[model samples]
Target chain A: MSHEELDQLRAKLDDKNMELLKLLNERGNLVKKIGEVKSKAGTKRFDPVRERKMLDLIAEENEGPFETTTLQHLFKQVFKASLELMGEDEQKTLLV
Target chain B: MSHEELDQLRAKLDDKNMELLKLLNERGNLVKKIGEVKSKAGTKRFDPVRERKMLDLIAEENEGPFETTTLQHLFKQVFKASLELMGEDEQKTLLV
Candidate 1:
């Protein structure tokens, strides 16, 4: 590939990165809302059943060169990050 | 919050999940192209300097309920998944 092709690909990747960042923040907003609801209801923050279902759903939908295990692992990280975000908000609310 | 509010929040989360999935696949496509370029150039697959720059950029941009460390860890997983996809493709190309 030429220099131009490489630069174009990198530019595309950067665009995708920005999109991911925006989507993650959007997800974080939803997580905070859900956390508040769960806190009010006296429910647990982490739902193992829902997590499993999400992994299963992703696996089913994946038309991947990526393995199911890799998708599961990556999604697990994403899930954990969202949970941590929600957990931190709950802690702050408790302290206030 | 009421049942209706919870349902709305959950619906929004589902949409975000789908968006994330699409973005991830889009990133994967770029990774594959970059991988091919790197293979031809005999360059390293893992670029620690570039990775650190990305993490720093994310931390700077983060208006987070999540800490920088958490972002770093989560992004490392995302990076790993992309690298794995690229590596697998490289292996297939080698075999052919």
Candidate 2:
């Protein structure tokens, strides 16, 4: 590719990466909200049933190059991170 | 502060942040290993009991500006991330 074309391609790639990061952060925020709901309900922070439903929804909705398994893995990490933020108090009390 | 001093301080801060990231990643890997052991033994993936023990150890070992609760929060996030990576397979099967 020409120099200008190469630069344009690099810029596009950077934009895509930035978009991914933005989406990830947004998802993280949502997870935190979910954690708040669960905690306030005096429910267990980790809900395997809800998580299963989430993965199934994603799998059903996905039109993807990525497999359901991969999506599940990525989102699981995201969900866990959210839960940690929500469970800060419990971590100290329960763990210590 | 002099420009030189400011630059040096910024560099130190960045270095410290990098060090923190490195330690976090190292801990993440260890958690994954722990998860493997837990799964093989049919132990529960999320261990609140062990986490509390960890916080206590850190608190006892700490001579620090950061409070025990703060450490607990940060490390809890790290541990959750590690669990997510380790539990990828279960996420799909269990969640779906």
Candidate 3:
């Protein structure tokens, strides 16, 4: 393959990265909204049962060049970040 | 707000998570293809310059409910996973 082919592939990879970034942010926003609702209802922010269910669903639906374990691990990072983001939003609401 | 509202939000979050999962797998496939090309051309798999550029672009584009730092951290996890995945592909190729 030519050098040009490699460049094209890299460009596509970069585009995919940006798409993933956008979805991450979208997920963050939804998590923040859920956090607000939970706070109002006096429910705990971290529901282990719900988290497990989500992870299980991910494992089931994963059709991957990535291993199921690998995808789960990466997703756990996103899940953790969303939890932290919820904490940040809760704090912001407290200050407001 | 009713319990139904919270359920709706959680459903949306789940949808987003699945979408992210699909995208991640799609990215994994692309990375695998790129790995094959790199192997063919006898080029190094890990390009720090390219990785740095992608991170910089992500940082620039972040309009986050999650902080930029948080998103960057998450993306870095993904980038690292992709690199490791490429390594795995290279090994498989070698075994063939």
> Which of the numbered candidates is closest to the native, going by highest lDDT?
3
DockQ: which candidate is best?
Answer: 3
lDDT of 2 by residue, B1-96 (tens): 234443454354334333333343444444555555566567687767756765566566544333446445645555555567667756655788
Candidate 1 displacement at residue A8 in angstroms:
1.8
Cα lDDT, model 3, residue A88: 80
lDDT of 1 by residue, B6-91 (tens): 77887888778777777788788788889888888888889899788778878887776667787678778889989988888888
| Model 3 C-alpha lDDT per residue in residues B1-96, reported as the tens digit of each score | 549999899889889988998999999889988888888899998999988898899889988877888878888888888889999887887899
Candidate 1's docking class is medium
Q: What is the lDDT of residue B29 in candidate 1?
A: 77
CA lDDT for candidate 3 = 0.87
Residue lDDT tens for model 1, A10-83: 77887777677777887888888988888788879899987787788888777666677877787788888888
Assess candidate 3 and give its TM-score to the true structure.
Answer: 0.96
Model 3 lDDT tens row, A1-96: 458889999899989988988999888888888888898899999998998898899889988877888888888888888889888887888899
Native RMSD of candidate 1 (Å): 1.6
Clashes by residue pair, model 3: none
Q: What is the DockQ of each candidate?
A: 0.65, 0.02, 0.86
TM-score of chain B of 3: 0.94
Q: Highest TM-score: which candidate?
A: 3
